[model samples]
Target: MAQQLDLVDFIAGLPMPAATAPQLNPLDLLPRRPKAWERLVAHVPAEDVRISVSPTWTRVVVEQLREDGCGDQLLGNGKIRSHDVPPDLIWPEPCRLILMTADSAARIHERWCLEEAPGAGMSSTFRFAQQQHADRTPVSQQLRLLAEEQS
Candidate 1:
């Protein structure tokens, strides 16, 4: 005869669900600021630097402060580089300069999708929340304020 399985034993072996589901905020999904950002910003001349933050990356542009007398100098030129913001970094402060455009938000959502397991896209509710956040926040103005504060 086949061995009999106890129903109570099987039920006990299953994992227990949490009493309350944790709340999810869409802003929590945004990319974090890069490490050592303050040091980087401090070293560069504030007026010559332009930093733009998107959901996937942070772009730092340090323009040349002086033009060469020989006319060889590149106008409107500087070093341009991008930093990928990992998921573990902290939010707020430097991250206050968020790109609020739909293109940027879509890129962020795409990145989140790729980072997660296949077929695990972000929830519609969270997407809506993100849109609301983008709408209410004047991020570009905040960026200017943050830059001023840093300087």
Candidate 2:
């Protein structure tokens, strides 16, 4: 005849709840302010930069990003998730990119950033053609204007 199963062993094998629930971080609730925002605002105010929004892109403040749950993406890789952007943002021409950074004070700063295509400046003809077009202003020119305005 087999012996009866031990009650203590069975109870020990059962899952138990944690003594305390995970504590929420107070800082997480606070508005996220990356250092890049301050530098950008100092270097180029929001008004100075022209944001051409798209369904996948937008110009938003750190607070808005945090509120909209974009802090992780913005803080992690410095790249905003296209699908995460709000549907309300209207897309326009001449999109301006902003890079973010964090400072010692936990403040956020914004700065102008752009991505150039590979071999984009390889040919003078392309540059000349760009220069010939007066109707459309180049990104470099717009960036120069931002610098000039700050000075």
Candidate 3:
């Protein structure tokens, strides 16, 4: 058999991914009180792509990780993947969200979570970047305001 897959059926069967781990900086999901999002971070291939999208690159696999339906999705080569957060998530508080690059250029990445755990105590980290990956995006999108640093 050619290793077949039933993706459509998989996501439907997925039980709204739980916070399988603990939370670190669990920012209250209340939009009015705080604008922070409750992200259940995971891991994958490249955390960010670092593109200048005015001129698109069709074959670039990095951009797909940012899409909503990216999870469990397949590429032309028929491989399903995601990106990983980066490093620097170690050290103590400050910017607990540690972002490390998969490459020297600092384009893509892996992940390590740091969020708030509901009743689990104060906060904890699952170390997803070292374990697995979370999502993917370009350097421009991932680094956000730090593009100049990579240049």
Candidate 4:
């Protein structure tokens, strides 16, 4: 039938599909807006459940903080505060909660915690990540995606 031939012609005229791009991993870039708890959970050290605190995020400054005993905070631009803070601010064992004030400088507003975990250091990246999460910004997750794409 004429209709049958037309159908066959139509099918023949259709182009083949193009090659597909590689599949992207979701974990590569964390979402721009994720739950605050997620970021908190992500930053906390799973093994010890303690977040080290730092007073500043400079090479020389950090060394000083480390020397001063409040130097347990991990890498990043956070100045850990709290002189009488107990351990487990992030995770409470003796419930040594982080003491804080909603204080702000010219360019930054900080919530601080005082801690003496002996030899524990909280990851500042985690703190940065936590702050971002509180603001619902997951921009840091892009690091993973970018690394994957480059690889």
Could you say which candidate leads in TM-score?
Answer: 1
User: Which regions in candidate 2 have their CA more than 4 angstroms from the true location?
Assistant: 1-72, 76-84, 91-97, 100-137
lDDT of 3 at 100: 27
Give the per-residue lDDT digits (tens) of candidate 3, residues 30-66: 1111111113223322222111221122333322223
Local distance difference test, each candidate = 0.33, 0.31, 0.29, 0.29
For 1-151, candidate 4 gives per-residue lDDT tens digits of 4545588788999998998866433222222212432443354332223222234323322211122223233222344333433443433332111221112110121122112234444222222222211432232242233234333
Rank all candidate structures by their lDDT, best first, as comma-separated numbers: 1, 2, 4, 3
TM-score comparison, 2 vs 4, better candidate: 2
lDDT accuracy of residue 21 in candidate 2 = 47
* CA-only RMSD, every prediction: 16.3, 18.5, 21.1, 15.2
Better of 1 and 4 by TM-score: 1
Model 2 weakest 10-residue run by lDDT: 120-129
Q: What TM-score, to 2 decimals, does candidate 1 have?
A: 0.23
Expressed as tens digits, the lDDT of each residue in 31-123 for candidate 2 is 344566433333422322322212222224322222242222333434433334454443222222233221211121111222222121211
- Deviation in Å, model 4, residue 23 alpha carbon: 3.5
Q: Give me the displacement of residue 63 in model 4, in angstroms.
A: 23
For model 3, the superposed segments whose C-alpha errors exceed 4 Å read: 1-131, 138-140
Which scores better on lDDT, 1 or 4?
1
